[model samples]
Target: MLQHIKMYGAIVLAMIFWAFSFIWTKIAIESFQPVTLVTLRLVIAVLLLYAYAKATKKFQYIKRADLKWFVLLAFFEPYMYYMGETYSLTMLNPTLVAVIVATIPLFAPLFAFLFLKEKISPVNILGIVVSLLGVMMVIYEPQVGVETGFWGIILVFVAVFSAVFYAITLRKISSHYKTVNIILYQSIIGLFFFVPTFFITDYATITDIKITYKSLEALLMLAIFASVLAFVLFAGVVRKIGIAKTNVFVNLIPVFTAVFSWLLLGQQLGFNQWIGIVVVVSGLFVSQLSRKRKISEKIEEITQVTEY
Candidate 1:
């Protein structure tokens, strides 16, 4: 129980860091182009992850056969995921964007069922339904007056799908490489993918950049907390609790994002958004209960065998 609490606490901290990501992106994008910002962030991420991998001797696990999976993961995650998210944030409000991205777990089961042929339990389906309603409530502004609302939503959905693929694909990846190796190689490859984009998108300005206090602070927080710590915590949770249980925590991200936006960015969440957060959190909780029940049943069966 204490360990579980610690896991959730880590997730809460991660969500707080992530909540600031919208504001950070908005600020960073003011001076840097989308691809350029992603490039620079990934470069920094690669350096940090590389250092971590070396410090822990994780690089030794990177066999030649694992290179393909690492490259593919980079394609799905930081490369495609961050790019789409960056593009979408430019078109929508940060709060709205966070709300939209919160539907990642809604699509996770669909991806699992489609690609892995994993059966979705009724509770999982219900969780998806409730979370979908929550997402709708959160993002259903009276007037989506932005010219690019449709495209922004589509891009956000793309980010969600890419994340789902990344999560489900991790099993295949782990068969080939260790987690730190995967993180390192993926960031390295992702950085290289953004290399040419930097040139095409005027990446030269990144060096000439004046690091204002606010921008530098935001960047440091993003690099340290959002990128490194969040990923490490996420990986640890996956190892501790399995993917399905760990993923339930993701639904809580929107709740934190909304709260943080209100506190940090002075954004207001109407009653409807609050209701949405409640519904989503409730659904995720139900999913956890259902999983627990299954585990308990298995334990009972083992006990019965031992008694007999």
Candidate 2:
């Protein structure tokens, strides 16, 4: 029971860090270009993860055959995912971006069904529709003359799909490597991708950059808490429990993001947005019903077999 509590605690902590990540990115990008910010963030994360791996002697070398998989993982995540997310935040509010990102788990099972031949239940389909409705509510403000942040919404969805793709690739390689090693490789390979883009896009204007305390603090929080600590905790939770169960905790991200954005950035959610958050979270819970039922049935089967 204690172990279960600790595991859940870690998962919640990860969610909190991830929720705050949107706000941090918003703050950091005030001074740094999107690609530049991501490059620096990855560099800091790589250094921290490397030190941790070396100190604990937890580093595991990847097989030559599996090098491509790690490269693909980095491409989907730190490359495409961060690009979509950071650039989108430049146009949208942190709370709105967080709400969009919260849909990753809602779509993961569908991607799994399509790519991995995983079974999808009717409830999962229904959850997708409901969650999408919730997303529309949050993104569309009726009182506003126009659909606010239209392009930003699209960019964030790109990030969402990128994350779903990343999750799929992660499952394929997770068994072969430790979590720290996987993230370490991702950060290193991701740097190679980010550095070139940063130089091409922002390097010429680098001299105009004025560093600020908030930006520095935000970058550090993102590298340490959001990137390293959150991934470590999440990977530990997934290993301790399972992906399906661990993913259910992702629903808490928007809630945490909403609160933190309000407290830190003074970003307030309207009534419709609040209602949308609830509906989205409800959909996430509904989607997991089928998976939970399967787990329970498996447990019952084992119990009966033992009794026999």
Candidate 3:
């Protein structure tokens, strides 16, 4: 029971940190370019994660054979995913961005089944349907002259796709490497990718620009809370309870993002948005619980048969 509770808490905290990312990226992007912000965040995060890994003596196991996969993971995640999201947030509202990014759970299973040949249970499909309903509710409201740009929405969709791809890729790569090594190498590779892009895109003008304390704080928060801590907790939970169970926690991200935006940014979500949150949460719980229950019952039946 206590172990289950800890798992649940870890999932919840992970979602909260992810939600906070929406808020932080919104602020930091106000002053910096998308790739520039990403570059800076990756640079700081790589340094920090390396230090943590070395101080704890966790950095020595990355084999040369695994380097290619790490670089590939970095390409999908921090480079493509972060760049897409950072650009989208600059163009869209935080809540809208959250809603779009939250669609990953709905889409990831499909990609996983297609690419990784991972099974998607019927319950998971139902959860995806319900979660999609919730996402639609959050974004659907008639307004005069409310223009959601097509390009921004497209960017967020791509971000979601990138994340889905990364999760599927992670399944294959995690088998060959420790999560720490995977993340450590990915961050380093991502930083490598980010540097040249930053130079070509924003470095020349960055010297003349003023860096606001608010932006610095937001970027730092993105590095520490969203990037470092969230990934660590997620890796730990995956190690403990397995990734199948750990994934359902992602459904809570949109909920926490909405709540935080309301409290901190004074953003108001409409009645329909609240309903969407409920639907999404319900679907996720039902989907995960149903699968677990079925597995437990199968185990019990096996035990009974053996006893007989």
Best lDDT goes to which candidate?
A: 2
User: For model 2, how does the per-residue alpha-carbon lDDT over 27-105 read when each residue is reduced to its tens digit?
Assistant: 9999999998999898998999999899889998889989899899889877988888999999888877887777676
lDDT of 1 at 262: 77
Clash number for candidate 2: 0
Stretches of candidate 1 above 4 Å error?
1-11, 204-211, 234-249, 292-308
Tell me each candidate's TM-score. Answer: 0.82, 0.87, 0.83
**Cα error, candidate 2, residue 204 (Å):** 1.5
Q: Which regions of candidate 3 fall more than 4 Å away from where they truly are?
A: 1-11, 117-120, 141-147, 237-249, 292-308
Output candidate 1 Cα RMSD.
7.1
Candidate closer to the true structure by TM-score (higher is better), 2 or 3 = 2
Evaluate residue 101 in candidate 2 and report its C-alpha lDDT on the 0 to 100 scale. 78
Q: Could you tell which candidate, 1 or 2, scores higher by TM-score?
A: 2
**Backbone clash pairs in model 3 (N, Cα, C under 3 Å; residues 3+ apart or in different chains), count:** 0
- The prediction achieving the highest TM-score against the true structure is 2
The TM-score, computed over Cα atoms with residue i paired to residue i, of candidate 2 is 0.87
Residue by residue across 154-255, what tens digits does model 1's lDDT show? 888887777666665555555556666666677778887788777876666767776577766766666777777777776666666665555555656666
